[model samples]
Target chain A: MSRSARSFAVAGAVLLAFTGLASADAVKLGRPALPEEIKAWDIDVRPDGLGLPEGQGSVSQGEELFQNNCAACHGEFGEGVGRWPVLAGGQGTLTSERPEKTIGSFWPDTSTVFDYVHRAMPFGAAQTLQPDEVYAIVAYLLYLNDVVPDDYVLTKENFPTVALPNRPNFYDDDRETTEKAFWKATPCMKDCKPKVEITSHAAVLDVTPDAGKEGDKPAGAVE
Target chain B: MNQMKPGSRVDRRRFLTLAGLAGACAAVGVQPAAAEATPDPDIVNLPPWTQALGAGVNNHPYGVPSPFEKDVVRREVTWLTASSESSVSFTPLYALDGIITPNGLCFVRHHGGEAEIDPTRHRFMIHGLVDKPLVFTMEDIKRMPGRTNRVYFLECAANSGMEWRGAQLNGCQYTHGMIHNVVYTGVPLRAFLEAAGVKPKGKWVLAEGADASAMTRSIPLEKAMDDCLVAWAMNGEALRPEQGYPLRLVVPGWEGNMWIKWLRRIEVGDQPWGQREETSKYTDLLADGRSRRFTFIMDAKSVVTSPSPQAPLHARGPNVISGVAWSGRGTVTRVDVTLDGGKNWTTARIEGPALPRSMTRFYLDVDWNGEELLLQSRAMDDTGYVQPTKAELRAVRGVNSIYHNNGIQTWLVRSNGEAENVEVS
Candidate 1:
C-alpha cells in the first residue's frame, strides 16, 4: 500500500478505537432532573407575589388566627413583641429620626410575608400550618400593614394585587458606582492617614488590646 | 517536635490503626463496642454523614449543618426578638479547630432562611444620606479593587451568652462556642462609604440583605471607615451559599450579627435604626432593669481544645496539650494554662504566628500523672487585658445577660484520660 493509504488506515483505526471507548465508558445511571422536580425545589415566593401557590385566605380569618397563634410572640396587631420583627406600622419613617423595619413600612414585598409563614414560622414547628392558614396569616399581615381592609381576601387569584410601600425604595444596588468612585481611586499609599488619627480609642472603642496584655510573660519563657 | 519512646509510638500506631478501622466499621453500619455503650456521657459523638440520605441529589447544592451540629446552631428562644422569620444561630466555636470551620460545621444566624438569591440577578443599592444614590450589580463588585486577609474569629455578641449566670450547657460548644475564624477577601467598606461620599450629617450606615427577611442593621460610619471589610470570599474561596455566598459584611472584633450576609443594600443614616436584632435579641439584660445595648466587641478568651470535652487525652504519659487562643480586640499576647485548676498557671508557649484578630495556637509541655486534675486557660490580649474568671464576669454583669461571656473555662481531666466541662469558682 502507498504511504498515504497506510496513514488513512491508521487514522480510521484510531477513530474507531476512541468511539468504542466512549460508548463503553458511557454510564447513564442518574436521570436528568425533570422540570417538575426543579420547579418543586425552586418554589420560593418573592415579596412581589412571584411564585405564590394557588389558594385564598380572608382577613377576618387571618385576624382571628393571628390573635391566637401569633399575637403572644408577634404581639397584638403585629406590632412585634420584645425584639421580634415588627409586622405593622413604620409608615413614612424611612426619613424619620429613627427608622424601624416593620412589615408595612420596610418590607418590599407582600409575597414575602406569605412565603415566610408558609415555609417556616412559629419558631420550633416550622411548616405545620395548612395552606389556607398561611393565606389567612398573610391576609392578617396585610390588614396589619393597612394595605388592605380587614375583609379583603388574600388568595393566589388576587395575591399579586397587593403592593408594598418600600418596593420603590429598594432599587437594585449598583456596585459600579463604588468601583468607579472608590475602588479605582488611587490608594493613599504615600500619606495614608499619617498615624491612623485616633479619633476615639475609648475603652468601649478600644478595639485593639486592652494594654500590657501582649507578650506579658517573660519573652524567653517559652523556650 | 519532641520525640517519645518506642512503647508510646507503638501504642499510638495501634491506637490510630484501630481508630481508623473503627471509623470504617462505623461507616459501614458495624457499630463499635464503645458506640453501643451509652456514648461517653461527656463526649459528643457526631453521627455518620452517610446515614441521612433522605430526599437525595440537588436537594441542597450545599447541605445544611450536620444533624450533630443542629444543637450547635443559632436559635431564638423568643420571637419579637426579630420579625416573624428573621433569626440567628450561634457557631459552635468550642467544638472546632485548625482555624477552618468545615462548611457543614459553620453556624448560621439569619433574619430569614438561606436567601435564595441568584448572583446573576442580585444587586447592591447605596442610598440615603449620601451625595449620590447608586446601584451596582454583582459584576460591578468583581470589577472593584479588593484585598484579602486571613483574619480569624468573627464572633456573635451572644456567644457564650448562656453562660453569663451559671453554666447552662455542659460543654464549651455551648458556652463559648459562637465564634469562627477564617480568611476573608473583600473590598473595604471604607472604599464603598468613601465612594458614596457620605453627607457630613451621615453618622451611621445601614446594611441590608436580600432574603425574605430583608434583614438590615445600622453601623457607625466612623467604624465603617476605620477597619470594616465588605467580604466576598471565605477561606480563599467564594462564600458558601449559607454564608452569604456572593458577598457579606465583615466587622472584625465586633459581633457577627452586624456582618450581614447576602448583602443587598447600604443606607447611610444619622443614627442606629434600633432594629429588632439590636434592641430585642442582641442586647444584654441587667438586674438593674436597664438593658445593655451596643455591647459590640468580643472580649479576649482562650480554651484548651485537646484535653477538651470532645477531644479527650489518649495517652497518660507526657501529654502535649494544645489549644487555640484569640481576642477580637487584638493579638493574643499570652495564654496561661492551669493544670491544677487556678492554683498554678504556667505560661503556654504560643507556637504559630500571632496575628491580630486571628487564632493563635499554644501548647503546654507537661507530664500526665494519670490523676484527676483540672485544666483551664486564661488569655491575655495585646492590651494587657487578662480574661476574667467566671466570678469576675458574673460580678461585672449580672447573670441575667445572654451575651459576651469571656470567662476562663475549666476542664476536669479524669484518671482515664477523659475530660469534662467544669466550673472553677
Candidate 2:
C-alpha cells in the first residue's frame, strides 16, 4: 500500500465506522502482518509449547548468567532480596500463612518462567537478552526451584514435558455462582443493623501523606 | 492572560470563587452583565489584565491547565511503594466534580515504569493462530476500521487494598484514587483480531506491553471479543505519556493492570498463559489456601467524596453530599446514602442517565444540625450486585492478598465539621 493510499484506507478505519463486523471475514484496512515482525516480537511461550521459539540452553550456562545478572535483586539463591521477587524454592507452602509464591512454588507452568524472564527479566533492562540466555536462565530457575536436575538442558522440543507441581490447583473464576447471595435488587434500606460501632480509624494507621502545592513535589511522583 | 503567578499566595476560597466565575463565563458565553455590579472587598481586585490586552492565541502550541487551578493535580501516597518510577499518584478526587476525571488529573499507576516510547518506531503485532498475521503502525492502527468511543473505568485491582485489614488512608484519593473513568476512542480488539482472522483453536489472547515490566496478561477470547479496545486516544485526545501514549489496550471494566500500557503485541492461543502477573502477582489467595485466578470484574462500589478526610465540611446548614458510583457488570441502578451510618438511609438522586461499566454522579442533600454523623454510601448495579461492607468482604476473602478490595467506604464527621477515614461495625 502507498503512503497516501494507506492514509486513505486508515481514514476509513476511523472511530465512527466501527459498528464493525461480528466475525473475521477481513476488511483489508491495515497491511498483512509480516513474518519478520512477528518473529521479532511473538515472544510469548504457552504451556502447550505453541509459541516457544527454536532454542536450546544448558543449566550450567544459566547458572553463570543468573549469578552475574539476577542474584542482586532475586538473591544468590533466588530467595529474593529486600522486597524484590523470590524466584526459587517455597515448595509445599501454598497453605501457609505467608505462602512464598515463587516461580517454582506456586506457578503452574514452566512456560511462564521462560516467557517472563525473556520479555521482562533483569528488572530495569528487559528484552536485552538473547534467546539462549533466556532459555539458560529458565533452566537455572528450574534447578533453583527443584523443577529439574542440574544437568537439565531445556529446548523448545522438550518444553511441554516439564510442568509445575501446582498446575492443577487453579480454577476458573466462579464469582457468579459462588457469590450469588451478594446480589440484591432491593437491598436493605434502613435499620438493617441493630447497632454500629467504630472498628478502625486511618489516623491510627499513620500512613497518609500531607498534601502540598505542585512543584513542592514532582508531578506523577509518589512518596 | 490575567493569570496568577505561580507560588503567589491566593486564598483557596478566593481561588474557588474566581475559578467558578471563569467556568461560569465559559459555560454561559461570557455575559458582561453577569459580572458583579460592584466588586466585593474580599474578592481580589481586577489587576493589569483588565487594563491591558493579554497575549494573543497560539501562545502555547499545546495548552495546559489554568495557572490558578495548579493545585488540582494527581498526588502521591509516599509510603505506598519503594520508588516513584514503579509507584502510584492519586487523582484530586475531592477537588473534582461529576463523573469524568480530567485527563491531566487522572490517577497514574505503573508497574515497572513508563516506557518512553517513540511512536514512529512503535507497532502492534498480532500473530499465533490466525489466517493473516498482521502488524499495525500508529497510523495503521488509527486508520483501521471499526473505531469505537466507549466510556469505562480503569481501576487498579488494589484501589482500596489499604483498607482490606482496616481503614488506613485519610483521603478518598488515597483509598480510591487508583481508578479513573475515561471515554476511550480506539479500534475494537475484536476488529483487529477478526481482521487477522482467528483460527478455531484461539481461545485466549495475551496482551503485552513495551515498558520495562513488559506487563502481560492472558485475556479470555470471550472478553477480547466482547468490549476490549486497542485504544490510542483518551477523552478525545492522544493518550498522556503516563497513560501509554501512542497505543494501549483498554480492557473495559477489568482490573487496570490488564489494560496494558505501551501495548506491543497480542498473541492468540488455545489456553491461558498463566504468566507471572496472573499467577504470582494478581491472583487472590483465599482462606482455604486455594487461590482465585482471573477475578477480572470489579464489583459495584461507591464512596462519598465531599465529606472525605481531605474534603471537610466548611460551614453548617444545607450542604450537598456528592460522590461517584460505578459497576463493572452493568449500570448503577441505585446509590443509597446514610447520614447516621447504617441506622438511616436515603436514595441519592442519580445526576444523569447512568451508563454501564462507567461512573455515575450521585447527590444527596441534608440539613446540618451540627451533630456528629457517619457518612457512608452503598451502590447497587443492574446485575443486582449490592456493594459489600468491609466486614462482609473480609469474611469471604481473607486479608492475605491486597487486590480486589471493593468494600463500602465510611467517613466519620464530627460536629466540628472535620471528616476522618473510619470503619463502622
Candidate 3:
C-alpha cells in the first residue's frame, strides 16, 4: 500500500477507537427535571418580553413601594444614596468624564431592569418581591428617568414598548477589529523612545489601604 | 573517624586542640567565655525549636499555614464599595512564588455574600430549549462520566481596573491580584448538555447562582458546549465556601463573573438573555459614549510581582526578578522583561508548565549595583496577541472602560532597594 494510504488507514483506526470509547462511556446520569422546579429557578428575562409574568402596576403604587423598599439605597428619586447605584436619570452623560450609568441612561432593555429587580434587588433581601411589585417599582423608575408620565401604568402588554435612551448605543464587542492596530507581532525592543519619565505615582494618591492596619475590620469587610 | 562511646573520655590531642584555640582567643584580648565573644551565637548555641518537640499529626484535623506565615493572607481594600458583603478581597500575590494560588489565599469577589450551602440539599437544573430538562443532585453529578481536570486562571474582568487612569494601587497584590489560577476537577458541561440534547434553536445559556444575589450571566451556547465545566473541586480539595463550595460553572478564559459560583440553574435559550450584568454593568463604555457588550475574553496580560511596592528589594548584589503572565486566548509563548522602562528589553526565562488559559511564571536574574531601575514585563500568547502598554490601551479603549485592563505594568525600583508603583511615559 502507498504511504498516504497507510496514513489514512491509521487515522481511520483512531477514529473508530474514539467512537467505540464514546459509546462505552455514555452512561447518562441525571433524571428529568420537574416543570415546577424549572419554573421556580429559571427566572431570566430576555429583551423581547419573553419571560414576563402577567401583571400590571401604576407609577403611584410604585412610588410607595420604592420609598419603602428601595429609597434607603436607591434614593427617593433614584438619584442614589451613599455609594449605592443610582437607578434613574443621567440622560445624556454617557460621553462625560464620569458618566452616571443609571437604568435610564445606560441600560439597553426594560427586561433587564425587571429581571435584575426580580432576581437580585432589595439588597440583602432578594427574590422576595412579587411580580406586580416589580412592575410597580419599574414604573416609578421610568417616571424618575423621565421616560414615562407619573400616571403611567406598566403592564405585561406594554413592557416591550418602553424603550431606553441608551438602547441604540450598545453594540457587540469589536476589540478584534477596532483595536486590531494595537496588536503588534514584533513590538519595538530597544530605544523605542528617546526618553522616559514618571508620569504618575500611586504613593501620591495615598489611597492604598495600609498593610499594617489590616486587622479584623479590613477594607471591604463583609458585615 | 570512629564512633565514640557514651562514657568515653576525650583524647589528649583533642583536649590540646581545644585548649590551644581558647589560648588563641585569650591572646587576642577577647574573653572566650563571654557571650559577645562567641562571634555567631546561632551556630554556638542550639535554638529552642531544636530542643523541643513539634505538634503531633492531625493537630489540626485540616492543615493551615504556620503562625510565622500569618502575614501572608488575602486582604481587602474596604473603601472600594459600599458594603462589605458585596465586595472583593485581593490575593496576596507578592508573597506567593509559583503559578498555583493556595485555596485559602485565592481572591474572593461576592455580589451578595458567601452563601453557606448544604451540598446534600443543593440541586442543579438544566432546562429550557432542550429535549429533556434534567435535575442533578450533587451525587448524580459526581457519578457522571467524562470527568476531566483542567488548569486555568479565573480573572475578574475588572482586574487592574484602578490602574487604567494611572498607577492607582501601590502593590501588585492590589493592582494585579484579582485573579487565581487553579486546576478544576469536574465533568465537561458537554456531558450534561449532550444528555439533555440541546435543540437546534438553543443559541445561549443563562447560568444562575443560588446565592441571595442569584447572580446571572448569559453565555453563548457555542462557548457553553465548547470548554465550560460543571466544576465541583479546585486544586485538590472541594471548592472553598468563598469560591462556590459545592459547585460552580468554569467558563474557562472568560471573565470571572460569568463563572457563577454556587451555580444552580442553566436555562438554554434561542438568544442572549440581555441580563443586567451583560447590559449595564460588565459592558465597556467606549470614549465615543457607545458601549461594547459581551466583551468576555480577558486579553493577554502580565505583571512583575517581586520588586513591586509591597515586595521591595532587600539587598543590592544579586536579585531574581519574578512575575506571572497569562492569556485568555491561548498559552503564553513569550514574556519580555525590561529594566530601563521600554528603552531596553530582554527575554525572561519561563519556568514550569505553560498551559493554555493558565498562569505562566517567568524570571529574570540580574546583578545589581544599587542603581535605580524601572522594570516592566510584556507577554505574548500563541494567538500572536501581544500585551499592549498603558498608553497604547488608553489610546484605543480610554480609561473610562473600567473592565478588561490588561495593559503592561511598570514598577520603579530606586537606589535604596525600595520599589514604588509608577507610570513611566
Best by lDDT: 3
> What does candidate 2's lDDT look like per residue over A185-215, in tens digits?
5778757888889989877756677733222
TM-score of each: 0.58, 0.85, 0.89
TM-score, candidate 1, chain B alone: 0.79
Per-prediction interface RMSD? 19.4, 4.5, 3.5
lDDT of 3 at B170: 87
- Number of the candidate with higher lDDT, 1 or 2: 2
Global lDDT of each candidate: 0.63, 0.80, 0.86
Clashing pairs in 3: A219-B78, A220-B78
- If both were scored by TM-score, which would come out higher, candidate 1 or candidate 2? 2
Give model 1's docking category.
incorrect
Error of 1 at B148 (Å): 3.2
lDDT of 3 by residue, A124-207 (tens): 889999999999999999999889999999999999999988899989999899888656869787788888899988777667
Candidate 2 vs 3: which has more TM-score: 3
Which one is best on DockQ? 2
Docking class of 3: acceptable
Rank order (by TM-score, best first): 3, 2, 1
Better of 1 and 3 by lDDT: 3
